[model samples]
Target chain A: MSLLQTIFEETFKISYEEANQDLAMQDVANWDSLTHMDLISAIEDKLAIRLSSDEIADMTSFDAIKRIVNEHQ
Target chain B: MHNIIVFGTGKISESCSYYLTKKYNIFAYVCDNDFVTDEPFLGKPVIAIDSVAKSYPPNEYAAFVAVGYQELNTLRESKVEQLTTLGYQLVSYYPQHTPINGPIGHNSMIMDDAVIQPCVTVGNNVLVWGGAMVGHHSVLQDHCWISGGCAIGGGATIGERTFVGINATLGNAITVGRDAIIGSGAICNKCIAEGSVLITAETPTYRLNSHQFIRFSSEFNSRN
Candidate 1:
């Protein structure tokens, strides 16, 4: 499994296969304001990266998160 | 005196850099990678942030992120995180004559004449501009900016990155959520949800223009 899948599955309690760039907050079962923060923390920790406050707020889609991760890398 | 590296060249930075001189020896002003130049700021050398650690090692010199309230202070938050990860210790600034009666976090600044009442908990990267009054037991969360002359009532809880604008007033025990904006001169007395914007109505002039009003009001009042 990809690192993004692992992180998303771990943070949102979703299956690894369900984690994709097309996925968003509404598509996920348990995504909320609190869990979104958890997802951000997980992404930052696993990627060894830091996201700006705007970045954290704007990362609604899995695609956006992947984009940020790629850009930072 | 402690050696300090100030990050930013804008007005807020200039003011804090001046006030910081009271406690710290000025080292230099650092710039973002995009704003690199040989020009000096406030008569101090401006160094590129990318190479600041090489000449002014973080082990010896402390850092202050003097960025202003752009992007609801998220910009400053980003800079603080960047600088901290680079191994520099962040420092808070309380200008001369500013009264701080509570616990404030790192890289925050309380400007001149601002009064922090007892037991107020101020979080990281907060900016309280000049003449602001934060009431007792209020909790100001991280990355918030309280503009000049703002009066926050006692026991109010301000969430992260919330902006209380100039001369705004908040009633006692109000809870303002994250990413909220209480505009200038607004009087807020109730709880606000996240991402709320409270803008006061613009004051409209009289039907007559200023000159016409001045000419007509001489009998009643000339202050128009």
Candidate 2:
């Protein structure tokens, strides 16, 4: 699985099939503000890239996160 | 009076500067080279972090990193490391009104109205915002951020870099692991694993109209 997919699956405790670019915060049951921070931390830990609060706030969807990871990489 | 330089010009830095001005002489505000600004901060000169060492030597002046908890507190941690590497004495903020019975680590900011009970040990670079209560004998590890109005019970051990949101409550003797995130209004009773995230369930709102449920005094008088 892709890095983004793996992050979504582990952080959200969702299945790989449920993790997709179209998946948004509103679509997930456990994607609260706390989980959002956890996801950000997880991404940072896995990718070794630090994200500012603005970047974290802008990550509303999987596609946005992918874009952010790409930009940082 | 001891001269101290405050890093950053954000709200946290401003508050820390204000807190330090009472006891120490405010030397200057230091920011990154990329932060473009020529304005004076609270009537003090704003200089770049790299340039601070030249004018204000580490032996003569101290430093306080007033950055907030961002990126799971890694940003604040990095600033702490940078300030320490510069050989500046890192100062902590503990308001006179806030009772600290035990040792609090350097570079931590315990804001006003925070009640830290006896035997509470707070680690370095921690930020316990206003009105937060750290119960007796609780231990907060390095780089933790406890938001305003949080109630951490006695004997609780909060791990490194954990972020406890506003109004969260942790029960007595509970151990929260490293890099954990406790959401606002969450009541944690059990131990939280490392890198875990705990969020409270959203409160369900009632949809019934209040006026429809009220019993009028006139109706009671008519019945009498």
Candidate 3:
């Protein structure tokens, strides 16, 4: 899956179209701490890769997340 | 009456002993894995845990796992399964002092001294530690642990596998997502999304009459 699509699906638990740069971190209703960990766990499980604590902490925006995921790829 | 034996000597186990012994004629009170208590608990003989099988057949007794929350809920889950596979019926204990409004599903170990207010929904295999209070209309999903002295407010929904730390307080109308850990003594006034970790800043204390030229304790107390 594309990184953008993954982020959108992860943040919103919705389809790819819902994922956009305009998506605010706090706007999503389900974007609680438990779901945040679920998103990270899902991404790692899907791509078979682990994200560093620094990378995880720094990930707050779609653009920054794209960069981190692309580097992992 | 059915033969119900409570394992472990923890506070929960003791409460179970006190309650169940009054209701049923329990065969023996299982103490430590090795030594049995000389006196009976509430008039039932107290024996060691390991001697459970030796004294009676596995089918002869129903066992309740009264141990507290282990590392990551591992200890309770493992012991529940172990007792079941041994052909012993798994018993659940819920205190009547807890005012549960909605249906509490199977195998819940609710300790004494906890106050579950009205309109609270608790799922199966859950543990409500002693002195915890579930406020009215709060929905707690399955496998959640509400530690001792924790207070969940009304109109809150705690998702599955979540751990509410000791004395953590959630304000009314807040929603905590699945698998979230509310740190000890945390006071949440807003919705915590799934998997979030929250901590509250701790206040320092000092002796009231240390000649420190100030007194803050009485002032803080009166304000609240």
Predicted candidate 2 versus true structure: per-residue lDDT over B95-199, tens digit per residue: 775555566799888877688888788899899887899999899999999999999999999999999999999999999999999999998999989999999
Compute the lDDT of residue B222 as modeled in candidate 2: 36
Error of 3 at A58 (Å): 50
Q: What share of the true interface contacts does candidate 3 keep?
A: 0.00
User: Which 10 consecutive positions of candidate 1 chain B have the poorest summed lDDT?
Assistant: B215-224
Candidate 3 per-residue lDDT, tens place, B152-223, comes to: 888889887788999999889789998788889998889988888887777654212333212211222333
DockQ of each model vs. true complex: 0.01, 0.01, 0.01
Candidate 2 vs 3: which has more TM-score: 2
For model 3, what TM-score does chain A reach? Answer: 0.73
**Which CAPRI tier for candidate 3?**
incorrect
Least lDDT summed over 10 consecutive residues: which range in candidate 3 chain B? B211-220
Candidate numbers, best lDDT first, in rank order: 2, 1, 3
TM-scores of the candidates are 0.71, 0.68, 0.56
Sorted on TM-score, highest at the top, how do the candidates line up? 1, 2, 3
